[model samples]
Target: MDAAVLITIVVMTALAFDFTNGFHDTANAMATSIATGALRPRAAVALSAVLNLLGAFLSVEVAKTISGGIVDESQISPAVIFGGLAGAILWNLLTWYVGLPSSSSHALFGGLIGAAWISFGADSVHLTKIVEKILLPALAAPLIAGLVGFIATWITYRITRGVPDRLVTKGFRFGQIASASLVSLAHGTNDAQKTMGVITLTLISAGHLSPGSGPPVWVIVSAGTAIALGTYLGGWRITHTLGKGLTKLEAPQGFAAQTSAATVILTSSHLGFALSTTHVCSGGIIGAGLGGRERDVRWSVARRMAVAWVLTVPAAAVVGAIAGKAASLGTGGVIGVAVVGIAVAVGIYLASRRTPVGPAHVVDELYTPAEPTPARKVA
Candidate 1:
């Protein structure tokens, strides 16, 4: 392939990954609000989509992290990056299919790391930066958000203790709209920038830009548009999982979770930490459930999600390595990888059609009660 054609292909693939990231992480912003009936599912996503676009222009700190920080960009090729994106996109789809709220950010990191390691060597992957910027934040951001959410929930309820239940619920539902919007914006700040970084890195590798150059305006605009469009499509499956599967949420709990998560994500973005908004939001939901003393926190479901989180990086890495290796072969290899990726994507979509989860069904699971287990016989 011509250098320009290859670069164009890689850039398009990056945008596709950005689109997947948008839908995959939509639940991170609007799930709780939707669950609590704070905003209708469609309205919530529309609002999130707009806010995410605005947030993309807010800061380039995280973009810098991706363009220059993670891997030795000098040592990698556009094809390797394309393979990395393929890995992240496939992982995002697989997890979305299973209704697990895994970290799209981690998947991106893992894919890049795997591709770089396979293409060049271990030294090409930045260990310290990964640990400091990616790993540490992944573990801590969620915990911090969870704690804040728990306390915030406790305080919110305590302040409204004497208010009528109806009034309390109404007020908090309104509050959730604002808080959830903030989360959406925060998500844009962090998640959208990852794509910008990747595109900028591609430009640098292709000799269109100098190393350390931030994302150009065109890159930012395209990335933001792709993510916004994806967000509008909605990731109902993951939204359903976070909103209802992790814990049942009331309006106050929803408010707390969104507020806390937004705060954590915005802070991290400002500091250039490529934190997982999904992790922070999940933690917030769990914490909010705990805050409501009467609510049940389903540890079984949570444990399943935790298992997925643990496996996200390594799983994506393995797939990324395979894809990267194949792409490194030549033009025929690139074409082969693209064909396989498209086929896999198409298969997942076709399979999903058999048991569709759309906006109509997004909240149905939340309202439906689980069938009770049969009573035990007397011994």
Candidate 2:
């Protein structure tokens, strides 16, 4: 591929991943609100989409981390970045199809690390930076969010115990509007910038920009818009899973979870951590489950989400490694990766259409359990 053409392809792929990141993690901010009837599904996503876009301009600290902190830009090429993005996008799609809200951020990190390692060797992967930035925060943020969620939930119920049910529900539902909006805003700050960083890194590798340069204004706007559009589309499958599958949420619990997750995310962004919004929000939901009056958490669902979380990095890494190896074979190899990625993406979309989940199905699905398949219908 010509240098300009390759860079264009890489930039487009990065934006595609950003689009996936938007819908895949939409549940992190709005799931609980929808579940609690705090906001209509379509309306909630619209608000989140706008906040996500505005949040992108708050700071570029996280973008700086991504562009400079993870993989050594000097040792990698545009092909490697494309491979990494391909892997991340695939993982995001697979998780969405399964109604599992896995971490898009981790998928991105894993894809990049794996592609860089497979293409250029271990030295090209920034081990110290990975530990300091990605792994450490991944381990710590969710736990902290969960703990805060638990505390907040318990307090929410305690204070509201004497209040009338109607007042409590109405009050917290109103509060969810604010809390959920903050979570969306915080999401834009951390997640939108990942794509920005990838584009910046690609520009550096292609010699269009100097090393250590920040993302340009155009890159920021484009990335922000791609993710915002995706957010508006909504990830109803994953939203249903978080809002209704993992736990039964009341308005107060929804408020607590969103507030906790948003606080943690904004703090991380300010400090330049590429935190996973999915993990933190999921943990908050779990915590709220435990703190509820009924304490009716579905451990089975929690276990399934946990399994997905654990698998995200390795699964995405494997795909990225394969894609990276293929891309190393030159133009034909890069073209091959694109073909396979497109095929798989189309397959997943077509499959999802067969039992299409959308805003129309969200609330009804909350009250209805899946029908068990007959022997003849088992896939």
Candidate 3:
């Protein structure tokens, strides 16, 4: 393939991945608000989409980290990046299908690491930066957000004690709207930048942009638009999982969780840490559950989610490696990877239709018991 054609393919693929990233992590911003009925699902996503576009223009620091920090862009080809994106997109879809709120950020990183490692050897992958920027932040962001969420929830409840329950609920439901909006903004600042970085890296690899250059204006705008559109579409499956599967959230807890998550995500984005918004939000939800005195945090469901989180990176990496190796073979390889990717995507989509989960069904599904008891016959 011509270099220009290859770069075009890679850029398009990056945008596709960005689109997936948006819906996959939509829960990070609006799930709590949705759960608590602070905002209607469609309205919440529309608001999130607008804020996400605005937030993308807020900072390019995380974009710089992805473009230059993760891997040596000079040593890799546009094809390798395409393979990486394919891996990330496939993983995002798979997890979305299962309604597990896995980290789209980690999947992106894992794909790039695997593709780069396979294409250019170990030297191409930056171990130090990965550990410092990606791994450490992954471990700490969630815990910190969870702790803040716990404390905030506790304080919110204590302050509202002796107040009329109806008044308390109404007050916090309003508060949740603002807090959730901030999370959507923070998400744009952080998550949208990942695709910006990927596209910039592609440009650099194709020799269109100089190394060390930040994302160009076009890259920023396209990435922002793609994510915003995806956010609008709303990954109802993951949204359902994060909002209702993790815990039953009252307005106060929802307010606390969104506030804590937005704080952590914005701070991390400013620091150029590619933190997983999913991890941070999930932690916040769990913490809020614990902090609400009457609510029970379902350990069983949490454990299932935890297992998915643990496997996400390595699983995406393995698929990326395979795809990268195949794409390295030349034009035939690229065609083959594209065919397989599309097939897998279609398969997942068709399977999801068997038990469709839409906005109309999300709250009801959450309220339904996972296992219903069989009735005994009366003699």
Where does candidate 2 stray beyond 4 Å? 60-62, 67-70, 126-132, 271-274, 365-379
Please give the lDDT score at residue 248 for candidate 2. Answer: 86
> Candidate 1 on 1-379: residue-level lDDT in tens?
6788778888998999999999998999899989999889889899999999998999876445463467787667887888789889999999888778988878887887888888888888888987786678768876888898899999999999899999988999998898888888877877788898888878988899998888888999999999999898898878988888888898999989988887877777677664678888998998898888676788887887888888887777787888888888877777888889999999998776655677755567543323332332110
Question: What are the runs in model 1 whose C-alpha is more than 4 Å off?
Answer: 59-62, 210-214, 271-274, 365-379
TM-score of each: 0.91, 0.92, 0.92
Error of 1 at 307 (Å): 1.3
Worst 10 residues of 3 by lDDT: 370-379
Model 1 global lDDT (CA atoms, 0 to 1)? 0.83
Tens-digit lDDT track of model 2 for 143-252:
88889889999999998878999999999999988988988987897789878988998898889999888889999999999999989889988998999988889899
User: All candidates' lDDT scores?
Assistant: 0.83, 0.84, 0.82
Error of 1 at 333 (Å): 1.2
Best-to-worst ranking by lDDT = 2, 1, 3
